[model samples]
Target: MMRNVAILGASGYTGAELVRLIAGHRGLRIAALSADRKAGMRMGEVFPHLRHLDLPPLVRIDEIDMGAIDLVFCALPHATSQAVIASLPRDMKIVDLSADFRLRDAAEYRRWYGQPHAAPELQAEAVYGLTEFYRDEIRAARLVAGTGCNAATGQYALRPLIAAGLIDLDEIVMDLKCGVSGAGRSLKENLLHAELSEGWHPYAVGGIHRHLGEFDQEFSALAGRPVEVQFTPHLVPGNRGILATCYVRGAAGDIHAALAGAYADEPFVLTLPMGEVPSTRHVRGSNYCHLGVVEDRRAGRAIVVAALDNLTKGSSGQALQNANLMLSLEETEGLTMAPLFP
Candidate 1:
């Protein structure tokens, strides 16, 4: 049976990516697409790359017919999805690609995002949308909150090691480089071509990045105690991808074994061989995460690296994967395309 789906905020980067992936999906049909400012515009007009697809014209959220849709992919900006999702039909299944509901604690959301959650009740109900770790819960959840692209990249490198007690809980650091598209399609002075081109620098310095809330919440839950990783994210001049290098105090061989064993069966996460690292170029433009481990000269230290297209595996692609599981369709449907390589 074909499932009718909608993409809210369909004019943004993640929204456009969702449309591109769903265009190739067999089980899902695009029923409605919403974009407040771009309402009434053809999707192709907003994203010329997606013009080739036969898709619904953009409309206001209220203009969408809820009764005709089976699922929704809420790609709205951070801090905005709470109210919009709260207004949607209560019984509807949704996958949100925003930070609104990823943290289970409303207070934590407020601390990180600087405002009260508009829908605390719904916040408590949302399952974290790291599809591989929460597959069963996502399969049963009415709402699934997508992780930050930086957070997802870090987690793929560290989650299994943390769970298996292979890495030091007290000493962990992650330095990440992300493509500009991860900032969304919105206009900002710093994101202009003249400003961002030919250079790279870190943002959300210190312990301030909002995705830290997710890292703290999830890593703590996995280890049964508090685990805080020093995380810094750098914006690269390129178009789309994330590379996270995690430094940890652990034997290199054990870290590799634990990660390999953990993701051996996961369809979207690939664990590369020992001493070989992954490149963002390898996983660009697809729903895949490539992980690699390397030994540091310091005997007790190791470097674990992860790479993926932040727009795809880290955000929109991850959203579609959760949507597939929620609807009881094949988990890899529309998501198995091999990572785009040069």
Candidate 2:
């Protein structure tokens, strides 16, 4: 049976990506799409590329008849999603693609986002939406908090090593590069063509990036102690994909074996041949995360690289994957499409 779904904030990049992926979904159908500013406008008007799809016109969140929807994808921004989702029908199955509920602690959320969480109760109930690592929890969760794109990429590269006790927990370092699309469709001078085109530079340098909160919460839990990684994210000149290079203290062969063993049975995550590196181009527009590992010239160190489409695997595609589990639909449904290439 087809499950009717609603997508809030359908005017943004992540929201539109949800529509794109859902277009191919056989078990889920878009019953309503909400974009406040674009209310009353056809989805095609806001996203010409999606014009071919026969979808509902954008509407105010309240304008939609929620009774007809089975689940909702909250693609709204951080604080916005919190309040909006808080007031939503308590029984509605939701997948929140925001930073609002990712962190388990309200104090931690306040410390990182610079505001008190509007929905502490919901935050406590939301399952962290890193599909591969938290499958069972997500399957039973009423609300799932999507992982940060950068954080997801880095974790894919390092989490297995951390869990298997293969890498030096104290010396882990991740340098990640993301495409401009991860910034969302918001207008900003810094993301303008004149400013960001043909250039790439690191932001949130040091330990200030908010995704650190997630890494801290998840890695520490897995390691049974505090594990702080030096994470730096750079914005690259591209439309999609994330490439994360993780430098860790471990043998190349050991790191390779650990990663290969961890993701061997997992779908959507592929481990490449040893000494092979993945390029962002390889996984663009798909739900796949490609990982590669190699030895560093300096003994006892390995360079592990991971590539994925931040908008796809890191966000909406992941949300959809979790939604599938929550709804008991085939896990791979609507997600089997291969990565698009030139």
Candidate 3:
């Protein structure tokens, strides 16, 4: 029996990605698609690349019949998803690709998003959807919140090291570079082709970026105390992928061993041979994360770098992985694509 899935905000980048992946999935069908402003338009009209797939016409969320949909993928904007999902049938499993339910604390949500959470009850119910770390939780969760792309990259680099106690948690720094699509399909003056084409610059400096809420929550929880790392994100001129360079106080060999041991059995995570770092181009358009460890000249310092596609592994693809778990299907059923290399 094929499961019927609905994609809210179907016109956005992540939503289109969901469509792309689902079109190839053998057990899932695109039953409904919603785009508030693009209602009544065919998905092909908005995303020409998806024209080949036969899909439902885009409609507003209110027009969707929840009875026919088994799963809902909410790719709506941050604040919008909460209100919309709140009104849906309580039993429908949701994989939200928005920031609304990612943070556990409502206060933290307000602090970063500048508004009280409209659905605190649902916020409390949402499981953080870092597929590798929260696999069991996601498998049983009714609502799963997809991680921030940059946060995902940094965590993949540091989580294993922190969990194994191989690094000095106090002296950690994460420097990340992301492609433009991570900003979403929204039109902004800074993301315009002319301005973003040939230049690169850092935004959200000084721990001001909202995704830190996730880093603070997940890392601190793992360390059993407060853990704060200097995180800086820069926008590169490319269209997809994220490469994060993490500096930690630890021996290079230990960092390599910890990562290798942690991800040895995991399918999507690849810890490269020591001293061989990953590049964004290698993991582009795939649900794979590659990590490399190298020793710094300073005896107690090491460099850990990770690469992944910001859109795939970091967002929509992650959402689909969580959805597969919640539905009791094989986790890697539809995510077998190899990275597209130049």
Misplaced by over 4 Å in model 1 are: none
lDDT of candidate 3 over 1-342, digit per residue (tens): 799999999999999999988888988999999998899999999999999989999998888999999999999998998998899999999999999999999999999889999999999999999999999999999999999999999999999988889899889999999999999999899999899998888999999999999999999999999999999999999999999999999989989999999999988999999999999999988889999999999988999999999989999889988999999898987888999989
lDDT of 2 at 38: 86
222-322 per-residue lDDT for model 2 (tens digits): 99999999999999899999999999999999899999999999989999999999999989899999999999999999999999999999999999999
lDDT of 1 by residue, 26-145 (tens): 999999999988899999998999888889899999999999999999999988999999999899999999999999998999999999999999999999999999999999999999
Give candidate 2 regions above 4 Å deviation.
none
- The models' CA-based lDDT, in order, is 0.94, 0.94, 0.94
Error (Å) of candidate 2 at residue 44 is: 0.7
